[model samples]
Target: MTLPAKAIGAAAFAVAAGLSILAAVWAASAIEGKSLRGVRAALEEGGYTWAEVAVDGLQVTLTGTAPTESLRFRALTAAGAVVDARRIIDAMDVVDPSALGVPEFTLEILRNGDGISLIGLVPSEGAHAAIVERLGDLAGDGQVTDMLETSEHAEPEGWGAAVDFGLRAMEALPRSKISVTASRVAVMAISDSAAEKARIESDLRRRTPQGVTLSLDISAPRPVIAPFTLRFVMDKAGARFDACSANNEKARDRIVAAATKAGMAGKVNCTIGLGVPSPDWAEAVAMGIAATAQLGDAVITYSDADVSLVAASGVAPDLFDRVVGELESNLPEVFSLHAVLTPAEASETRDGGIPEFVAILREDGKVELRGRVPDPLVREAVESFARSRFGSTAVYAATRLDAGLPKGWSIRALAAVDALAHLDSGQVTVRADRVKISGTTSQPDGRDEVARILSDKLGEAQGIEIAISYVPVEVPEVDLPSPEECVEGINAALTRQKIEFEPGSARIAPSASGTLDTIADLLKDCADAPIEVAGHTDSQGSEEMNLNLSRSRAQSVVQALMGRRVLTGNLSAVGYGETLPIAPNDTEDGREQNRRIEFRLLRIAEDGTTVPMALIPGPDTPRPKARPGGSDSAEPAASE
Candidate 1:
């Protein structure tokens, strides 16, 4: 091993150099390990679990898909905090923000007497500016508070239309809250009255843009009533309320329920308003209505705290007294009752010297006037007025001239005649002190009309009694013809007059208009009947050409009928294409017969196939007279 002095020195130096290289490598590996561990720990502690960290030779690299750029940046800062900033490498990627869902854009505009306030997110700054400007213009003297935020997204479909509609609606309703979205606009407002509410709602609905859903919550405040009034009557004509008023919804419902129980029918509109005599107004009204119903024929009127009850002329005295006593006893302390028992013959004068006038209207539309008139001139005027109302031929006047009659005797006679005109069959009696109208009418508000006429003509204080009853007018049902009959009838018309068309063309001739008119008239009564307008062609052309030509002809006929104001919803056009020939196509006459259009009755089978409907035997259905050359095979004529 020990050779020479020079050789030994060289070997020693080489050994020293190899030892130094190994030490440097070990220190570098230790530093890299320490840096990697520190950076990974820092990222984990900072909640950047998505980040991947690696350190190689003093350089730290971070790689991963971070949920956001802020998160990625935070991870890098955290890694830098644990190591040298210069050694850190950012290989991290933030997730694409476009992958996230688009934000919803909405706007709510509230407008009141104070001002307008807008709040919500908009698609862009343009939308925000448009909304602010529109609201500012609407505000006028009031301030517009804009709290709308903008996003840089595109405007959604229907957003502009809905916003414009909402703004228009807001303009219409001064005090309203409008909520606008891409597809809907909701408006909540208050109106001055029920009529105003209805008008506003109708206008808003009519003006709503297409594809935009509209929601409306319009309310009308209760009106103020002075000397609140309610008048209910239960007479021979059934029961009804002449005038109804309540303070609130509950009170109105209670009053309506009482009226309904007392035999009132149909919808009853009870006014809910401000002035009420007492909180127990509904209670008093219910009790009064019940008592009137018990009496059978009575009238009750309420004016503020004063109540009046009047029994009919023929009401049982004992029953009237008992009901009136009960009603008065149970009424609220704030109410006062005035009871009146009409005499049996109160409609007639107590004195025999009071000249009476009467006009009787019969169901046959004839009027008979018999009474006493003031003079000849007055009598002529009365007769002339009666003739004008009841028709010249319908009137028969026979009144004795009386110079000593009352001052308004002519007026009373004329008024009686006028009132008599409204009754289907009834009479009007005019006395010196009262006017009595008794009749049946088809008008639902006949009694009210008569009362109004008397009040307007004679005066409200004049003694007036109405016994008008409403009788619903009955409508007679029409018997429509069966589908087979309808087709047969149409064919019958076609047979008599052939619906001629241009040679080898679908154009209908002008001469065929009369036949079409006849058929159109027949179809009006049975437009709902299913019918097939089948077209046929002779074997003179290709099957396809014949089929298309026949179909066009059939459709042409249907269109012609439609032009004549006939309904074609149930009519279908079908081409036989020379398939179902009634006659041989070899001869001219046979071909003529084969090239005709026929109507077949249609019926849907269980399998959804349309088959020819069977002919129904109907002897009662009148058939038109057949011409000399008309075909009488029960099938309608096929026209070319």
Candidate 2:
């Protein structure tokens, strides 16, 4: 609104000033828009995707996070390209360098008849090409499948040597799996035979680089033993060992010595392998061959520890028996001997129609005379010989006088009585044609002695048919070892192999059956013994569960022994559970050792009081853990 002259002048000045202010505001907005567009274009061209750009007036500002400090600086430089370098404001934050971590690396190499395969993380230094090239050079015609990934981490120390060693090992191990790490390499291989297996293991161990640990598990197929047998045959021609399986080198040497001694001719090749009953294998086999050799025409065979010897019917009965008895007594505790002494031929048993005389010596120390004696002179001489050989108080004359007696009847009868006197209980049969003497004695060569005596007496014209046997005193003899000794032996055996049960269960494992078999064999010699079969367990489960499991296991062992024909009449089973741990249960090995089976002997006085048994320690005895106060019932045992 226009008013007067003075008011008009003031209006004009105000209007001009308002127009100037409007133009400046519009120009400033245009400059800001242009600066923002230019900075954005520079940033896009420079590839700063994470950088944020803003404009106010002529100043350019940044606010977004940068992947790295270098990227952030490049973004600021790009913005300055469009404006003065001082006009750009750097507010961008770079991420922490540690946020991007070093990579972890691993590798697996698999080999088979088909070819080789590689998989897993590896250092990117060689990339996939270098590793594949190395594999091709080593693997030869084997197809190599390279499926590898890589990381930027620096290669670990010793990584190269370990990888090289691992690959070389894989070359030797045709069918194998190799796991490689920075410091360790594990190789598993299979060979067609044990010889090859040994070679593979030896080669691998030699090639493993220093500072690198190599775990090798090389395997071979089990040798098939068609019947797991051995046959040692000695005949009139010679002696030989066939299919002899020795437990060790010492056993082989001893067995060979035995065979050669019995006339085994030529080189003996005994196979050494896993199946052997005991360490005294050679000694037992040698003695067996010797027994067969004593028998003229015979064959002795062994299946594991079962020994069988068969002699032809015409073999001297006394000799056959003496040889067999010696073999039985000399054999190791693990062996069982079965001997067959066929009777003499029927012709040998028939009478020759000659005047025969027989003398019988009973177990009661009484001597009975029968059959025909020569004239009174000869009869008296024969009776006098018996009285001289056996004490006069023990001789009884029951002979009839006969002039038909042979020329040397008196001499033969006297010799026969002298031979009979050496027997425990036996008979002597004499005839003009032939003299037959038979009896049992403790003397080792008692059977062959009669022939020499008769020959000396009859001027080598008389032939004596001898049938004598020798029986050694039984083992553990009439006087048994103390109960403590039996327990010690059982415990020592247990230390070799513990009776194990299934995990989290009371059932015995199959591997335990072998140990149980050994126990059963031992108990057979202790038939009269009252032994305690106690079961123990690790501290793994609740006391009640462990107690129940231990009891079941002990009962199972007793039943198993009984199944093997062991006398359980004097055997009992008990459980101690986790209360009696032999070792700490914290470690896996300790826990395994803590779970065990123990045996103890029970002795009772005539008054029914329990008597603790103890034994002197030596090569024959193992030290007792403790002397139990009572029997293996609900009471606490003396030791673990």
Candidate 3:
């Protein structure tokens, strides 16, 4: 429709521009609608819905967030897989890395007879193999069930440390269920005993990581107290409860207050126990403890609901009766009372129907108590006291049940125990009102003290016999002389006496008997000393023959000593022959001396060290080795 030149030119230019725009549009659509779309579809289908692809002209671009760098790279590779590797335009942005919001990581470990179980998430950096190996070692023959997942994301701060601490705690708490998280670990378990519970708590505290929170709930049931008991004793040392039990704090408070009024001096710990007869347990115990205190030195005990109140021997009968009446009236409905006013400590006033209590002290460090014990509680208290005071392994109580014992028996017994401490060894017999203590002590006033304490605890009319004797200081033992001293003594004695032998023969002449007798006398004194009768010979004959002759002569001397009834237990004869002559064999006199028989004091020490004690044969005993220096009867056979 163009008519002019300018019109035609503009129409042609507009047409060309339209075609160029269509061409660009076609190219853009081809990449975006096909290749880019295919890439996006592939990413989405490949389980990466987070990836987005876009296109401009021939360039393909990626957008949107990638959870991790690996996924981000994977999107690039995915596009490259669909088209030319150079065509992939990686505009993808990875999600910003931040600390885990809640770390909300969890782990549970269960341990039982069957095995150990590990179930939960674990950090990727955690060496799973090492942990699994450690678990396997702990598992031993037992099986281990592991169902754990690891996160690619870096662990939150302190996460690794918390898990490690949790694992260590698991080893210590074998019978526990442990719940571990990045920030906290909770332990639930049962402890076999109080000691075990304390051990577990200590272990967890020591091993738990500093930044992690730990909660431990360990349970241990109350120890059973059979026959449920209470024993409160009042004396000069002030009032005390050997064992106290209360059902509740209210009851415990009341009982404690009453004991305090009665002179309880130390930290009083009353056990809170179950099975209290009634809610009024506190009232009953308090009233019982208070009433007994008024009667003077007393012991109030409870065996289940059966309450026993015993007063000292000298408690006035009227006062005892009034106190008992008041206690019975004030007691709870479930309680029953048994009251007794002990007879005078005088033996004549005591009932003869009940047997006495006997406690024996043995040299073997054993203390035995038999006869009567007031009640189950008193019995247990006494045994415990004995075991603790004397020795846990050495004390034995064989006491028989005898609630019929005289009123003041327990008091006298307590006094007797006090008395026993002063004695080194002894026996205590507690009867109706009489206490008989017999023992030995180094303290001068031991007897008086035993009597004094007994009288003090039992009051007037108390018959306390102290058949105690004072032990004098022991004398130091004399130490026997060492082997060296014995040797010195033997050598000196042999020098004084010399044996004479018949010419050329091993026989000792009759003239030698006097010398033999003298030597034998010396031997008698040093019977414990080891004497070596060494024979020396002059070079008068062949060395071998002289050696034989001297040996025989020495044997004769030994026989003479034996004949004199001297102990030869330690005496031995050894012939030195011509080897160890005291004098030269050259001159007559020197040879005469050389021919002489010599005695050497030999000391064999504990280590077998031999030393020749050149003894003067002082005062100590002497023992001889194999030797013959006399022939009292005739020629003696020689052994060289």
Candidate 4:
């Protein structure tokens, strides 16, 4: 291997240069391998299997279709963690988000006495601002807390319409919650009364946007029963409640249970309401009812903290005394007791010589005040009270001044007049010893109402005899007819002879009474079928006035039918006003046609949904029973 020094040096230099180049290449390859492994491992562990990692020298490259822009950004972040951020190269393609689909947009608006609050995401910032502004206007001095977010996407179909409908509902309902979406709107609200709740629900459903689903959960607060009255009577006609009321469900159940145990059969409707006289109302009522049952042939009335117990003429004196004593002692301290035992035979008057003060209420809402009055001042007061109750023109006073009348004669006369107002037609006879109310009434609780009025107005010790009979609506015994058939028959009758009302009044004209009689006969057989008595008017008056007038006319028809002993339990009175016109209002004949009374069959489901009978599929079916005072919808028939 011996050689010259220059030659050896050149050979060594070449060998050394070649080895250095190989080492340099090997180091670069190792670095690339490490980078590739680290990045690939990082991507896989981060659930980015769609990404493909590559390394060239010191640069790391990500290449593949990412499912989302977020995923693509995530891939770059993962690669950067493994290598220098500056050295990481992003060659990834993001999948089109439009292909995936747009997000769902929703809005929730809540309103209460404290004010209103809005929440959820909207399609645009403009929509968010508009919604907030509308709610703020409605809130007045109340607060409007906005908790909304916006997106840069187009509003979905039906979104704007649904929101607008929901806003309108919110404006009407002070206590409510409205949930809005593209396809549905759900409203939950509280109303002042059952009637008000029905109105709100009907208005909302009627105005719901087309193709959008609407759900309603409207509640009416418990009614405030002034004087908190409850009257239970058990006699030859069996047991019943005149006007039962309780503060809550638990109390109502307890009171009803006591009545049932006291031989009150059938369904007992104990109204759950407010203004309880005492916390132990149920207990007190139960004890009184139980005492009445034990005594046999007795009447019990509770007016606020006052309890009145009257025993029948046949009740044993000893037994009456014992029962009365027990009830009085067992009653809560808040209550005051007044017990009375009738004689074997009720006397006509204190001495059978005092003139009887008679006030008669007729079916036409007229009251005839006759017989006697204590003095001129007493006469004036009695006439004024009668006029106030029975209407100014409806009362006819012809009482002579009598100075020899009893001390409380004026009060008895006033009380008699007041009680007479509860009956459809009745006579109230006030005497020194007793006040007798005898006549027929259309009210289900007419007798009870009269009893309560007299018991409250007169002292508990006052002798009272109520021979008032309920003129029960006669439901003709026949095969049940389908609702549609019933409505068609009614419309057919209307076509032959229309039911005409007095000009600008709800009163059925004297000539129309015969037509009503014929219609009443037809309705007797179809008492259980669901029907809507819709009233429409010509466009001659203000919209609101027309609406009210139409409603009164519709209700008047129902009342007229009731007076004819026809069962109108299934009838619903709805006023379309000028909204539904059968003919052009420009012509007198056309206007006459527009002013109509239509009988439409309503499809009422067990779940309380009301829709037009035509919209319901399948053959028409007979309703199981009568349903009163429900929201209604149906197709109009011939005008009257």
Clashes of each: 1, 2, 27, 0
Top candidate when judged by lDDT against the true structure: 4
* lDDT-best of 2 and 4: 4
Model 3, 273-374: lDDT tens digits are 566667777878888888868876776777667777778777788898899999989888988888766665444325454477787877666888887877
Q: Is candidate 1 or candidate 4 better by TM-score?
A: 4
In Å, residue 126's CA in model 2 sits off its true spot by 1.9
Candidate 1: count the clashes. Answer: 1
The C-alpha stretches of model 2 lying farther than 4 A from their native spots are 1-104, 125-127, 137-142, 231-640
| Candidate 1 per-residue lDDT over residues 265-378, each given as its tens digit | 988757778879899999999998998898888777777787778787688888888888888899999999988776655343344556788899999999898988888998
Q: Give the per-residue Cα lDDT of candidate 2 at 531.
A: 65
Whole-model Cα lDDT per candidate? 0.79, 0.71, 0.69, 0.81
C-alpha lDDT of residue 95 in model 4: 81
RMSD of 3: 27.0
Ranking by TM-score: 4, 1, 3, 2
Error of 2 at 435 (Å): 35
Query: How far out, in Å, is residue 398 in model 3?
Result: 16
Clashing pairs in 1: 491-636
So what's the TM-score on candidate 2? 0.28
TM-score, model 4 to reference: 0.54
**Model 4: residues with Cα > 4 Å off, grouped in runs:** 1-101, 112-116, 124-146, 152-161, 205-214, 346-355, 401-405, 421-426, 436-452, 465-640
Using TM-score as the measure, the top candidate is 4
